[model samples]
Target: MTVRAAWLLPEGQTREDTRLAPVTPMAPESELRSRGGVIAGGDPLKATGAGLMQLRIGTGRAIVQGTDAQGAYPIAVTSPETLTVADGDPQHSRIDSVMLRIYDGLYDTSETTTATVEIVQGAAATTPVAPPLPPASLRLWDVTVPAGVSAGVGGLDWSNALADRRRYTTALGGIIPRGWGLAFDGAHDGQYRDDGAAGLQRWNSAAGAWLPYPYDSGWRPLALTAGYGNPGHGMPAAWRRLGSMVMLRGRIAPTKTGTTIANGATIATLPADIRPAGGKEFAWASPRDQTNKGPSVTRVEINVGGTLRIFESHDLPSWISLDGVTYCTD
Candidate 1:
């Protein structure tokens, strides 16, 4: 056996001089960075229009496997490709598949090395299912044909009949597509993926799952009960969530200076979603008055049910500080 490497030609050699073999390995090398799928952008392999027993596939670029020895290759569809849909079974509904196929004459022993769109007709039975894809093929869409459907009679109901089977991939180190979630075997841990509707997600090897990106909820004003109001300062009673932790800040006072705040009086209620898993208590500083003598402390309780209350034995202070009050929501 002999070994052949590419691009070692001396100066004055044109690209054709290399027989394009040097460039052939480039695509497969880059394609291996990402799991095989359609490149994300511009309605790749999208179903543009449908008619009776027919479907049209829009322009797209996809990477798919070639022969095991040949590795992977890319297929580009510059123009719309129309495919014929098999007539539906008269007795039961059946699912058909639209596939993008590659045929390399050198390796596949075909007349020409080319890529084409083909339809794999499903079996008609009481419980019909989509046909399995052939070797060197990628499924672009799954089409459902109801019983007794035929050409030139009625068009397929695209909304209900077509299912998008196209997944996406990007340059190396970019967020992987949602469809390739299970394809990675914990080797790509710490990498991110675009989870479509769920937004961005990160792979966790330990948990063997994709976790949502951490986020912080901006501060929102806390709804104070009757008689309790902002202390007329810039800092108003507010709460926010930072990942699993919830933080509270601001100061609250009675609407009137002389208003009597009974012991264990409710100050405000926390939103149900940000409530703590268990009851929590915090010691907060309160303004000192003649009745309280010197600096005083107030006990603030945040119950599991989201009630925020204050406990004090002596007369209520002018204002209570809720700043520096933080707890874990979990």
Candidate 2:
């Protein structure tokens, strides 16, 4: 983490331009002018005088220090050699248009950019060494706190685990209380306007309430309909009410051992008492419609150990194992 490796020097400064040296603990302690030492009297072009040298240390990353006209060090005076620019030669030209540049290894060679620097004489005390930054750990998501932010809060980016696309449509309908039925439709809530019917509704978790969605013309919100048996029509009491969400908590399936059946094996002839635990294996005959689009189960086979085995049919051209897991096309 110390980024002291790169610096923004004036145009004329090269990697080894030699006007300064690396600031080491052994180097005599020179106070950075309240700003960096600066020389105001001479033309910046002709004078190698110091002022703007942007220093990159660590976290929250930029620093400015330099010398002034009177020379009473405002910014500490350091040997130029200590500053290192990334791609450009330390030997840079002193042209006004030139920018001192230094780059950390964050980018490839194609993106080299010059850094900007400002120098001041005795403008401030020695730049404070920043405290060590906690190493950043990348999680499934990264939250961002915009500028002018306060303590402990940031906007969340949940997209890392969320779907990118969603589709919707419109359905003209009336509200029904929970568990009620519709006149021409089906059973809604039992009472005329009791809760338990169906209509547009939202869950108000804090109040443990189910608020009715506005049905004014042109106003629509996401909705949940009743199961195939019940579709409540306009009974206000039957309006859909929010309820506790049901969460079916379960763990991933337990691991199972698999035995592959070799070619020419048959599984249909196995005894009905065959246990799946043993190494029984078999392959099935390829299906006739054979576009390889349909599923076919292998015949059950019995190994010497009394275990049951079944062949797995796979895609054509490759005959890879489809494994016994059931698949659905809907």
Candidate 3:
């Protein structure tokens, strides 16, 4: 199923209406814009293919059955252009709540005006077919609490999503609560959450949150130049990355200080840790001398493709152990 999010002009709404933006864009995706990016009033982006009549919403009637109370659902929209929730599995219960973003940007809720609509699932009648994303599994929710009774687990003050929609301890029932997502304390509150380029995740969606699947978020360790320093006590070396920044650190033995390396020579070959993106060049901090020599020893580093160059002040001064830290671009 595909849903749509829009900034509809209310019957009397104005540009200065002080209302919240209609659709909260997801993080790391639609936030920053480059030279070629979304501008105000830009048409919706293409789904999987090129231009298609993707976004559509209009007046719809909420189903009514007998005197249980005729509830009228207002303006239901699902399956935005960015995603599509398709049917799955046979036993999978044919109904549940789907995640969505209502307000795109920060705005005053007090100033915004709109009627509430209860979110329903599987076209308002869960009968097993056309259920949103599935793998053929049955989920039985324990929504047996009697009405008009101060109760245990109610889905929410809003949302008619079934009990299994939350974090369910049994059979992935996922009995998650409303207003909780991605960061719930429990083990599972939601279902498979797509991390864009990262991959997919499983959660309870309601009572639980998205499961933790830490990606190689750019902090990988790189083995330093092996045995490049003093023989048995080669300079202890380690390097790590964080986003666009790379940190390199190492220590040299006391006796081998000023006499360890050749003048104006490369101390070690760089690991992939600090290789600039696309092999492009980036400015990095100059290397330092930490032999407690104060002004007696000075060191500098130069990037030669993927090599580290070192220069010393005196070239042949006996000194204590030394430790240094330097940074580079990722």
Scored by TM-score, the top model is 1
CA lDDT scores, all candidates in order: 0.70, 0.24, 0.32
Give the candidate number with the greatest lDDT.
1
TM-score of each prediction: 0.57, 0.12, 0.32
RMSD of each: 10.7, 29.0, 17.2
Question: Candidate 1, TM-score vs. the true structure?
Answer: 0.57
Which tens-of-lDDT digit does each residue in 1-330 have in candidate 3? 222222322455443332222322211111131011111121222112111211121221111111112111111222232322223223334433332222211232334433222222353233443234221111222121122212123222212222432221111222222311234333323334443344544444352445434312333333334434433454445565554556555543223433455555545566644655444322222234435444545454535467655555643322222244444463
Put the candidates in TM-score order, highest first.
1, 3, 2
> Candidate 1's residue-wise lDDT over 1-330, tens digit each?
011112222233344433422223221223243245677676777885557767888876676665566665555666687888877887999888888776655666665555678788898878888898776677888888888888756867878889888766555567766663345432366667776686877767777776676645689999999999986874899998877888999988898876655679898999987888988888855556536365556798989999999887456666777888999888
Q: TM-score winner between 2 and 3, please give it.
A: 3
Task: Give the C-alpha lDDT of model 2.
Answer: 0.24
- 62 Cα displacement, candidate 2 (Å): 14
